[model samples]
Target: MKLLRNILFTSTLLMSAFAAGTAANADPGRFMDMKKSVKAPIGHKQFCQDNGWACPRESYDPVVVQLNEELWQQLIAVNAEVNRRVKPMTDNDLFGKEEHWSYPVNGYGDCEEYVLEKQRVLMEAGWPKSALLITVAKDVQNSGHAVLTVRTDHGDMILDNQIEAVLPWYSTPYRYIKRQSASSPVAWTGIADTRVTTVSSVSR
Candidate 1:
């Protein structure tokens, strides 16, 4: 009787462990990629006004403003703000799990989703589309990851959720991969290094 009871208990424990593992693997939130940017048409006058100049201005002429230095400072400040908001979620917390209720840091987001959110917030804060670049690369671990690259006059800086401090692109261990254009909404074009295979629901 003792032997039978012990066997039954061990079998139950094994089944419970297997069920838990299966549940984790079956989670639906694991596959959501990042959201793509939306584009809308703008009239010539609206475009010009949005750009803060006349429509027929010279193509390559720089905008003449008195506070160019101050504008640059403000851009830097906004970048810092974005880093502050996203770093905690990416670095300290586990992937695909919410950390806090107030901030509501998304718990189950993949790398692409994180980048999308960061780009969206920065755009809302008035950063130019040209200033932000979405870069896709393989990290040191050879796992796929996406990060935001901020192009400045100095150099390109990477705002990764994996680290708190913003570092220049060349300083990181990631290999250089193709960057998503600020002007285009396409999720991918072609990679310079490796051929990427994108899978869709229909493929299955």
Candidate 2:
């Protein structure tokens, strides 16, 4: 059980680091605004077809979680634990397809899978379905990537598999693209990020 103890220690440390970065709830500018409705990602569409329960489409009022210390700690623990437990494997290698989104059944998945798992965990923990959003973005390399966006009264915080510490939407390096709408879990909305940046894909 040595490995289990080490994992617990690491999770605690992650939660502490996230709590230290806590900020008071701010104005509307801190929250990322939604634009026109957009189509859901292909992988997500197929994922919904297969796992409908995970993607709740029922209409409800948008929820912005009031970020309390307890919830903040929980988010950190969930984010870190999932990132640590799940090994990164691309869709093609794992499913023989270029793009596939599903839970990490074998403890392996790509970026979007991480997002899905985290969202699921939080929902199971009593977090609202409207608050946890599956977001798409262009990574630092300008490659397509996925991250979990958690809406809260403090702001729109991002829980990314690539990064351990939760970050505000604006603080992330990604050029915001689109995400599931807060009002409707299945509906998608565009992110009007007008920031211009130059990034080129790196060939290994």
Candidate 3:
């Protein structure tokens, strides 16, 4: 009788552990539901391969080169536009318009909106579908927001509307959670620091 009770307890614990693991790994279908919620495309496998610190590309296609150059130029233009538009607004202005910022729009957007818009424009400009990725992070103040990361042959560069210069990802202070990929749902390797939250977005 004692042996049977022990076996049953162990089996119950194991089953509970398995169920928890499955839920953790299951896809949440966020991409399918939020397809139109954001502008970028759904497929992100190639983007992950290209932007990862380790991958290498042989050479850029002529078309890719042209598109990259054009997109680079456009990113610069958009950064300038965002700075011009958002610089004057006080913190209260942003808080007051938080609802507008949350909704998707064709034109006119806040910081995150500007990033998403720029990402879409870059994709349309001919940059490799994988070259542009939308990264959502908590700002220094712990506010949730989005930014654009451009994966280049050398490394990933950040195009932030808050700053005119495009800096490398490591240079920025924002803590990374999970980046949106074209091919798969978001993944979190680890948090940058204790302040950074684990990825809260659902996988597709």
Candidate 4:
């Protein structure tokens, strides 16, 4: 009887925690929208060639900024899945070379694959392609890194492999560089008008 009581108590606490998290998880009004500059990193073409990943031929209309409980739920679900499923690996370890970007065909892939998969899944799930962008940023080590940026009415929230939680762009630790333009997915665009020197990564 005592053990049963303990288990019930723990379950209650867990539910309470989840409720609090859901309530506090997404509050767009607290964040003011800001612009960040971007530039395409070198070797993208060669990287695409090496990995057999096709570059997007064209762009699409940006997803209308619609932020509600459902959109936020979708964002949270996708971000959590990608973060958990894709193992972190460098291009060198995975491909014996650098900048080898591709979608995750197997269970493991690099950072770029994480972004690609997230973009693909969200699109398949009926999210607008334009709102989903494969973004490259400079990490804490100044190394080039990739993430999927989801544009919404609240702001641009980052969906990253290194982090499980979806956060506003300004909350991340990396410096925003270049991202795929919503109007043209194949073409890159700058994140202009802002500088993000440090954004805290959820995990190392």
Q: Which predicted model would earn the best lDDT?
A: 2
Question: Count of backbone clashes for each model?
Answer: 4, 0, 6, 11
TM-scores vs. true structure, each candidate: 0.45, 0.82, 0.48, 0.71
Candidate 4 residue lDDT tens string, 1-204: 453344335434543544422222243232233344344455455555554434556656667557777677788898899878888777788878766777774678888878888988998898888788788777766677888888876567778887676766655566666677778655667653134424432211
Which scores greater on TM-score, model 1 or model 3?
3
Model 1 residue 91 CA deviation (Å) reads 16
lDDT of 1 by residue, 107-190 (tens): 334455456556667667766555565676666555656677776543455666664445545444454455544344332223
Per-residue lDDT for 94 in model 3? 51
- What local lDDT score does residue 112 receive in model 2, on the 0 to 100 scale? 87
lDDT of 2 by residue, 60-157 (tens): 99988987777877988999999999999988999998888899969999998899999989999999989999998878667889999999876788
| lDDT agreement of model 1 with the native | 0.44
Superposed by TM-score, candidate 3 places the C-alpha of residue 150 at a distance from the truth, in angstroms, of: 0.8
Which 10-residue window of candidate 4 scores lowest in summed lDDT?
A: 21-30
Q: Between candidates 1 and 4, which one is better according to lDDT?
A: 4
Task: State candidate 4's TM-score.
Answer: 0.71
Q: What is the C-alpha RMSD of each candidate to the true structure, in Å?
A: 18.8, 7.9, 17.8, 9.2
How many angstroms is residue 57 displaced in model 1 relative to the true structure, after the best TM-score fit? Answer: 24
